[model samples]
Target: MPTLVKRLLAALVIFLLLVVINQYMSKEGLFGFGVPSYYARLIVLAGINIILAVSLNLITGFTGQFSIGHAGFMAVGAYSSAYLTVYYAQAWERSLGGIVGGSLAHALIFLLAILVGAIVAALAGLIVGIPSLRLRGDYLAIVTLGFAEIIRIVILNIDSVGGATGFTVPGYANFLWVYAFAIITIVIVYNIVHSDAGRALVSIREDELAAEAMGINTTRYKVLAFVISSALAGMAGVLAGHYLSFLSTNDFQFIRSFEIIIMIVLGGMGSLTGAILGAIIITFLPELLRTLGPRLESLLSSIFGADNIPASVHTFLLQLANYRLVIFAALLILIMLTRPQGILGTREFGLSWLKRARRRPEGDKPVGTGGVSIAEQEPPSAIDRAKEVKNQ
Candidate 1:
């Protein structure tokens, strides 16, 4: 099939999926099938985290670079976007007047603000990537980590945007908006990974020295990957700011970056599917654990008889919420010990899945030399044919 045709088909499929997803998000339910609002919010967060993971995977997995400042880029995006929508929105709204108004105007403003923020964050990435690209290994990681701290400090001191008090952003993003951006990020990253440029990136990852010797511009590609990755992280931040309706430098702390890293690493670096799966798990795992305490308390009560349960034991069970991180960390450790390459490694779940499907005609059967029905026969293969010839 033509590339354009295939792309159109993919776009159509994506549009349909988004429609269904949006329908399911409606409060009254879509044809009696809908997720609760809280769960819907969780789903939106998963999509945002997925973007962060896939974007980081581009740099760390495909390009063989280590960056621990994803949250910094995210902060830049959120703050810039919030500053525009929250503070300067009326000015833009007035300027638009009859050109567009109401919800339409809001949507346009939201997208424009996000774009501006993404550009600003991309510029930041360029600044950091250029100076830091010369270094490698721990040196590079240190530089990126330091960059994150600097961003946090700078944002913290900006009193106009609330300083340490944080800023309240306008919540203009719905699940559909989140899903749209998520799809855009996925499509863009997937194409980059599969394109000629993507091949150059993989080459750099495999052996930078070899790729450089083969006439590839290693520094340029490294910086390109870094900037793109950072920009995507910024997009995620924009979505987050709009969805959560608030922003704080603390929210984009180094630990947040670490969580994104954990998602990609645990899902399997270099695999898009892994990054997505990892994002979903990391986002929902805490929510799942919140209920674990209550469930455990009830189960233990039933098992040992409620009257016999000690107050100390019950208190300890109630305190399980504080230990969720410990449990989450243990899960990561166990996963690492079992599958060091990550959940899916570098494998993909793309078109090859469809190519591998089989459709045999009904009532199809094999016949022996005597023209009698053969209930079972060896599957067709070159090796099987050779074995039959050898037997004859």
Candidate 2:
């Protein structure tokens, strides 16, 4: 079969699987099998974070731009899409429902909202990227940070989006929608990272001056990466808003941006899989920490008889839950200190990496047969040289 056909078939299979999983996650169980709401929410949020992390990685990791304003772009997408869905989605849904059933009409409206969010976010990225991308390192970071703060302040002042009260939106996003976009984001970033344009982005990251000298249009690529990143962040925001059925400016604060940065950094910069793994870890770690104390107590109770357990030790373990945040921070610090380059620095996890690891050295064997390699071959003796000359 053709590669395209195979890909389409694979996509179909995946979509079918997602549909089943979505059903299983719903309140009405799929054949009485279902995931708990707690886990469902975590998985959905992880998907959102994956989108954010992967998109940000395209610009910050692959393209070497330091943007700390992802949340700002997310806010733009969430609010813009929410506005449409709040005021116009019902009417559009009603009109389109007649043509394409209600279910699909609702989905179409959400898709339109996503498009609007992406476009608006991309515009914001372009506006910020053009002037700010000229500066490098700290200066660029500062500019982006300020831009995010400005956006938050602006949103707070806009009463239409509910300002301090927050905006309530319809729940159009679920596990399927969130993960679909997450997968799309990953594929888009992955394709770009492996393309000629991706090479230009990397070149700029390595040395902007050299890339400019080589006619790589460093600014153009940087801005492109930035806009694409922003657009994706916006899409994530739209999903988040719809999933939670609410939007608050406080949720898109600078701290949220830092959390995303931590995800990429902890996973390893310049690595797509690293970003994914990092996002998952960042999403789950806090929740896990919340239950750590009970888990530890249970383990100890099993190892040492519960009757033998010390009251002080039990008290300490129970109180551990209260300091989960501090412990979470400490764990993060420990990981960073130990693996500053991240768990996978500039490396990916896949079959290709395995193949590379098992490949032989060029000088370890002969060029074809079981003889010495060219670099290791012995020099010809005087008799061999004489024989060659006589034969010629």
Model 1 residue 14 lDDT score: 85
Q: Best candidate, TM-score-wise?
A: 2
lDDT of prediction 2: 0.94
Over the stretch 1-392, how does candidate 1's per-residue lDDT look in tens digits?
99999999988898888878888886877989899999998998998998899999999989999999999999998888888887898678777866876667777888898898789889999999999987888899999999998998999999877789989888888778888888888889999999999999999999989999999999999999999998998988999998898888889889998999999899999999999999999999988887788898899888998888889988988999899889988988999999999999998766775676676655653456444455454456999789999999
Pairs clashing within candidate 1: none
lDDT of 2 by residue, 1-392 (tens): 99999999999998898898999998887999899999999999999999999999999999888889999999999999999999999999999999999999988999999999999999999999999999999999999999999999999999988999999999999999999889899999999989999999999989999999999888889999999999999999999999999999999999999999999999999999999999999999999999999999999999997988999999999999899999999999999999998988899988775554666686665673356566676788999999999999
lDDT of model 2 at residue 304?
Answer: 99
How far residue 79's Cα lies from its native spot in candidate 1, in Å, is 0.9
Give the Å error, residue 160, model 2: 0.8
Q: Give the distance in Å from residue 23's predicted Cα in candidate 2 to where it truly belongs.
A: 0.9
